[model samples]
Target chain A: MREKTTEPLVRIRGVHKSFGSLEVLKGIDLDVDQGEVCVLLGRSGSGKSTLLRCINHLEGLNDGEIHVGGERIGYERRRDHLLPMTSRQAARQRQNIGMVFQRFNLFAHRTVLENVMEAPIYVAKRPRKEVKREALELLERVGLADKPAAYPAMLSGGQQQRVAIARALAMHPALMLFDEPTSALDPELVGEVLTVIQDLARSGMTMIVVTHEISFAREVADTAVFMDGGLVVEKGPPSEILSDPSDPRTRTFLSRVLKETA
Target chain B: MASATADPIGESSLPIRKRPKLVQWALIAVLGLVVAAGAFSVVNNENFGWPIVFEYFTSPRILSGLVRTLHLTALSMAIGIVLGVILALMHMSRNRFVQSIAWAYIWFFRGTPVFVQLLFWGSISALYPKLILGLPFGGPAWLEMSANDLITPYIAAVLGLGLNEAAYMAEIVRAGIKSVDRGQSEAATALGMPDGLTTRRVVLPQAMRVIIPPTGNQLIGMLKTSSLVAVLAYPELLYSAQLIYAVNYQTIPLLITASLWYLLITSVLSVGQYYLERHFGRSEARSSLEAR
Candidate 1:
């Protein structure tokens, strides 16, 4: 096992989350260094996705702290009292972080270019001309320059997910979170979206992805965290975790994934 | 061709069994007979004179009244649509006070007869003789206008008709808005847009697909309902016909003239509605095809 480092870009400590008494994440603690691609491998409902959501404050945490780029998210210290920040304040913090949803929640009313430009113009308050220029550049980066004027409903599932990534990247976020970006796509369409993400990973973007595509995880991620039952069951380098998992649950999950892939 | 003929019958191969030819022919014949009966009665009736009908329809008073009816319908529809959108947004607002106020507005207007509301508005002087505009505290000088002086019959009719129709329009707008998926709002929020801007730019455009058909229906309904304002002697189409009949005792002829104009306008509106629906539908169809 590699020695755990003290300096990390994202630090989650003793974080707990519950949705109306149904606890989804229980006491999760993990760290990802700067520019590291960490793939969270888990079955459905294993809290891997919820943990990624917590870092951006997309999902509220019941207890503990999350820090992204060394700034605390969803929490405030007021005269020795720790308070959960209001939703608007948390949203401002979320600006430094960007998320792509499992369902590729693109704004259906907007064209591909406008979808990428919306956050920069509305949230970041960038000038319209600059935002449009940057948005087109991001679209070209995702190999979707031809779809600039296409509404989401006019794009394939894979194309829409790629546009979603461009939309997130347009903000120039410090960390990008992807929650099963290809899970909702057709099997044939999955590779196109994964290739876009793989390209992003190769370009040294800090990413935390909750994904089921084990081969992509193994090939692209620097570290892999295996989660089960709302807890991080094991954490190590991708070769160690995917090839030689220590925990029985991790081994069983790998066996199932391998069998399905084969 | 041999294989196609030998294939077992599927859902579409039930012999295209339509109504028997005799039955269809009978239906058309019955419809024609009904129309002919109507025409014969009109032609034979003592009050139904073609020359009198033409004269009454071309009369200056009746023509002016027809113009007034059309003008009122257009003005009321415009005001109703604007008010309806605002009311819809207020009804959907998260603030409890605004929602309740909107609810009360729709409730009162929809529950009461529009005629009663018009009468009440026309006689607003009986309740509040003056219209005062000022803040609760002493912020500015009060601007007072007397109800009797300012509340003209035409203004009362417009207010009554527009406000009453707005209640129905609000429901249509709410339904249109609700038809959009909840995720659209979440996606807009994720993009960090404020709620109002999200609604204006993202939500309302999509909601228009659901809103426009029902609004077109409401406009047609309002065209017919505007005739009720004649009870206040606003000199609308129906009242103009009544005034002519009261003088010349040609009741049926004048009513036929008014009916002809109303039918023409409503038919035009119906055709407009059909084309608008088709336009929206075609775009939606194209988008779904692209999605697939």
Candidate 2:
């Protein structure tokens, strides 16, 4: 695989997030270069999903910084303090960060086409004619070209997730986040959605996918990150982290995951 | 699981169809008895005054009053539902100040009786007889109207009904809003939509599935509540019936006439509301496949 850029596409430095008094992310740090796929692997309550959400700015940081494509997300550094940005400013940062959810939260009331084009036309202020043309092409890319007029409830879970991916891609984000994107799918439906993500990965789309599918992670991830107890236990190339690990917790967790699936 | 369920032999050889239910037969007998009793009473009773009911069914004065009742119900509910939607949004505001303001308004309007509200609006002149339309005190007045002129019987009834109706409808709308999944908003945020556009384009439309049924109930309730305006001397169907019975001393028959008209109007509204509910639920419902 060709490494596209030397500069990091995403940088997390000492990022800490807490819900009320319970700390979820404890002084986490990681980085991803341009056009790299980082798969986050962790047991439940290991802060993998929380860290992913922090990158998306759905959860605010209690400390530290997150930067995507060299720009801080959700907060601005003023002298010595990191101040939370306004909602509008925070939303502007999301334009370059796409997210696919575990349950495929497509807008139920809108047609597949409307769901794809809404953010581009309304938020980006793109011309309607152009957005529609690109949105149709995006739906075509996701293999949903024939069902643009269909509602989300009418589509199967895998199809809905693909439309969600197309919706995020319409903005042409710099980085994409996946929060266990296929965890809620039927076993049969999981493969199609993973295939789409794999395709995106090979084509050099920078993404951070939090998932339990170790095989998919091994197949697509340039880097495998294992997190436990609100900390990154180990992160390295897929070959080292997925098969052999230095940390005791990482080995136990990976073995248990692999055994459960087997 | 599928392989275990497959037919290894003649699985259909001993098919047993559904048997008839005793409950169905009992229900039909009870309903037939009730209908027969009702018919016998209607035919035999003289005080019901069936002849008088038919005589006045299409009478000009009563018909006009019926028209007026329909008009009031339509206009008041139209304004009420619109105000209700705004209040619902305000109630959901993140700003505590705006949310409290919406809460106080809803509490004030819904806490009181609608009849009392109509009476209060009817006699508003006793409190603020003159309303000057200009800047604060001592500023030059641009226009001034006595409260009596503004608070006509019709306007008072509308104000009373619509304002009070708005409070109840606001609750219904809020319940609908709450029923929608939180993930919808989170997903919209993930797509880079600002809060306002996210709510307007995504949340509220999905909330419609929950909001529509209760809102239709509120519409029908508004129609019935419009009768309270009769106490304010408005010439609605009930008031007109009261006026006719006062001279003829046939209060029962007159009220029966008004009741029938209310029924007719509400039945029509029910049909329309049914279609409206179907339209809202259509997005998630498989209408064509379900029908089959």
Candidate 3:
């Protein structure tokens, strides 16, 4: 039986992040349940990507707490005071969370198979034989089994992104964050990458994706969030958020995007 | 007009070829004549003592000195590369103190001439007569030795060339590390690899594409710069050649012999550099090709 817990897998309370004088994320609060796919829709500079980065502690928060898997991200409570965690501690926390980038960011020096196998063999300290077997399986699942020996530069943008997804899955992360996985892909190539992600969602993996794909979000996300100016303007099922947004800003942004896509 | 143009195009289509350049051939002919004249003047001049050059070119003493030059180049380059990598990392460190220390080292070493550094290393005993190994600020000493005994001529040469080369190498390595995309390391960090592992697995390999060409230049530069140690009477290639000319009074010939050897070594090193560039350039080739 699935364990029923009152606490969600990811919790964010009043998270704020800034770069110098410019505040990107201002007083954001959200939660994601286990095995749920949360799609964040936002225009550029709306803090969607920053919010995703904060979940994995890739960006430290200015003022707030993010708890992933019940542990405070980038901080520890010591004697009723929150203290910043050391790099080692932060790294350990990140091990349970996998992240994919907009650009493929596959290691140029490594072959596709080696890229998938690297973190498990080095960071997680898994046996090479076992990691290799799982890496090939992940590649096959992503429809890239034949291209394992090829370097990332030799692959299409779509293929490289698929390999990147496989690489993240090899870590067996409890949660995955995708920062515009198909944003950099050609329009024709975007579907293949989205299909791979859809398969992952169906497999009951917890994921938080920052993307502009309204149709994909409608089909895939359990919860759809519309964000603007560093705040969530509306949150509901994808059907409601995409079809009839309560907020005027959400309506305008969706229409703009849909018109462009159309 | 269409029919007229199409008929000629469909026919043989006039095979294209480069224009024959009467001017270029005349220029080449003149330049070749001038070069031949210069060569004939040099070969025919008795003052050059060409016979003496051929005789000492394979002399045992000069050959041994060549070997020593090779040894010094290999040893100094190894030291420069290892220390350079460390200093580059320290230069890029987050700690203010560590970063400034690396900055100071690169500044001091690069600001002054390497020749002065070599001279100082040669007469190091004059500055510090006794070497002490102990705790800082006048603590108990564990070992002691004479600086003269410790700093041999060979050690001095290695220190002079390697330490100076390291400062330049540090800058080159820093530029190389910076050339890699920020996303590369970010991806590694997101995968939970520590800073050091990310640098090793992701950053450095990509950095090598930018690092190798300049490093090969440094290696070739070091090979020639090592001849500077001959001023200390260390019996390197130039010094040994000077010793032979001093006895026979065939100065010009012996200088020519040494120049020939230097040219040969540099040529070989250039070829090696070409192959190394090709090796690290593998991944870049596809992207560049696609771009074209």
Show the colliding residue pairs in model 2: none
CAPRI quality band, candidate 2: medium
- DockQ winner among the candidates? 3
Give lDDT for model 2. Answer: 0.90
User: On residues A174-247, what C-alpha lDDT tens digit does candidate 2 reach at each position?
Assistant: 89999999999889999999999998998889999999999998889999999998999899988999888899
Which candidate do you rate higher for TM-score, 1 or 3? 3
Candidate 1 chain A weakest lDDT stretch, 10 residues: A1-10
**Model 3: per-residue Cα lDDT over B12-62, one tens digit each:** 667789999999999999999999999999989999888988888999998
Instruction: Give the lDDT ranking, best first.
Output: 3, 2, 1
lDDT of 2 at A261: 85
lDDT of 1 by residue, B211-246 (tens): 889888888888889999888889999999999899
In candidate 1, stretches whose alpha carbon ends up further than 4 angstroms from where it belongs are A1-7, A74-77, A80-92, A121-129, B1-26, B44-46, B135-141, B288-292
Kindly report the interface RMSD of candidate 2, rounded to 1 decimal: 2.1
DockQ score for model 1, please? 0.44
Task: Chain B TM-score per candidate, please.
Answer: 0.87, 0.89, 0.94
Candidate 3 residue B208 Cα shift, in angstroms, is: 0.8
Encode model 2's per-residue lDDT on B13-51: one tens digit a residue. Answer: 776888989899999999999999999998789999878
Best by TM-score: 3
Give the clashing residue pairs of candidate 1, or none: none
